[model samples]
Target: MDLVGKVAYITGGSKGIGYGVAKKLLQAGMKVAISGRTLETVQQAAEKLGKTDKVLAIASDVSKHGDEKKAVAQILAKWGTLDVVLANAGVGHFAPIDEMSDAQWHAMINTNLNGVFHTLKASVEALKKSKGYYISLASLAGTNFFANGAGYNATKFGVVGFTQAAMLDLRQYDIKVSTIMPGSVATHFNDHEPSPEDAWKIQPEDIGDLVLNLLHMNPRTLPSKIEVRPTRPDKK
Candidate 1:
């Protein structure tokens, strides 16, 4: 697909993986729209990308269907078409299931699971019109279970399942769907600061490049699920 002039919407794009994807798409000549719950951060991210003309910054809460709907509408209003949708907004809460609060559990479920649902639901019609692509950023936790990961694991697992089923359901319309499961990415997720020691892990731009590769693939071929991790872990 010719990326030039194509439009893409990315949720949680103010930082981390989503921001990296936005930068890559813009560099590929796509008109990119990035959303954050905070207007200031979204604007800052757009400015950082340094493509005011090609970038649209929207303040949107992916957990809310209304916000997603408005965001899609805004993107269509500005670009007149939508070609890609990246449901990348997610949160993680680690606690024993017994000790987890309702807020913690709900936050993960709402943003990680229902958030993807809302973003896709709001954009499906536009995607059908453009025969676009949809990708969700899941996590290694989606498949591998661990202690203190009940909430995060549930949501990521749900994301993987939902995206796979969505792939089947949307393919008839030529709207490709896929989920990327990445391990130990270097980002500010979970409110942790990235340090030089994290360089060995997956970089945000690596995921960006992965998304670019997927977009360029032949429409007849679909890699419905991808699992990626670092080749070399940080030595103890």
Candidate 2:
């Protein structure tokens, strides 16, 4: 696909991986719309990104289908066409299954698993119309289970399965789907601050670069699922 002038929508794009991907898309000359839970935060992020003519910020909570529908409507209204959708809004709550609270478990399920569905459901028609791409931000935990990560793991696993199945279902319409599973990114997830000490971990722009690669890949090839990790994890 010719990325120039194409339209892409990213959930949870206020910062971190989403922000990095948005930057790359803008650099590639694609118009981008970024949605977050709060309008002010999304608007602030758009200002920080500094491509006023190419950026649109929307207040949206992926866990809620209504918000996602409204978000897609706004994107269509502004861009008239949607070529890419990234279901990147997610929340993590790590705890032993025995110790995890209902609130924490449900939070992960709603935002991480169900949220991807909501994003896709709201935008699939536009994708079909454009023969576009849909990518989900899952995690390594989706396949590799670990201690103190039961809730997070379950949600990510569901995301991977859902995305893979959706790929098969959507391919008939020429809409591409894939899931990205990454390990230990330096981001503000789970309240952790990214710092220079995180040098050993994958950086946000690295994932952004991967997304750009996926977008540029030929349609004859589909990298349905990708697992990415830090090159030198032992450095930590």
Candidate 3:
């Protein structure tokens, strides 16, 4: 598929991996609308990208039903069609299952799982119109459970299952779906600041490149699930 002139909507796009994907899509000549819960951050990122005409930044909380509607409405109003939807907005909460607070667990489930559902609910019509694509940013924890990561693992695991089933449901309409599961990405997730020590982890732009490749793949074939990791591990 031709990326140039295509339209994409990305959630949690103010910074980190989402920003990287937006930059790549803009570079590929795709018009992109990006959402963040904070207007200031979203505006700042949009301005820095210097593609005002091709980029729309909206303050949206994907976990909210109303916010999802507003976001999709804004994108549709701008581009008249949606060719891709990247449900990349997610948050992590780390704690032992026994020690996890209700707030922490709910936060993870709301953002990582419910948010994706809201995004798909809002954009499925436009996607049907364009026979577009849907991609979710899951994590290696989706399949690999770890100590102190119960909340995060549960949400991501649900995401992988949900995305896969949604893919099958949408295939009859020619709408493609895929989930990217990356291990140890150098992003400010779960309150972990990125640093040079993160060199061993996959870079945000690498995920961006991966998304571009997925978008360009032949229509007849769908590589529905992808797992990526750093080639080298940081030595202890």
> Per-residue lDDT of 1-236 in model 1, one digit per residue for the tens?
89999999999999999999999999999999999999998999999999799999999999999999999999999989999999999998898999999999999999999999999999999999999999999999999999999999999999999999999999999999999999999999999898988999999999999999999999999999999999998899
lDDT tens per residue, model 3, 1-236: 89999999999998889999999999999999999999999999999888799999999998898999999999888889999999999998787889999998999899999999999999999999999999999999999999999889899999999999999999999999999999988888778889998989998889999999999999999999999999988889
Global Cα lDDT for candidate 2: 0.95
Give lDDT tens digits, candidate 2, residues 105-170: 999999999999999999999999999999999999999999999999999999999999999999
Candidate 1 wrongly placed segments (more than 4 Å): none
Clashing residue pair totals per candidate (backbone < 3 A) = 0, 0, 0
| TM-score sort, best first | 1, 2, 3
Best by lDDT: 1
- What is the alpha-carbon RMSD of candidate 1 to the true structure? 0.6
Give per-residue lDDT, candidate 3, residue 47. Answer: 95
lDDT score for candidate 1 against the true structure:
0.96
Candidate 2: lDDT of 130? 99
The top-ranked prediction according to TM-score is: 1
lDDT of 1 at 196: 89
Q: Is candidate 1 or 2 superior in lDDT?
A: 1
Which run of 10 residues does model 2 get worst, by summed lDDT? 227-236
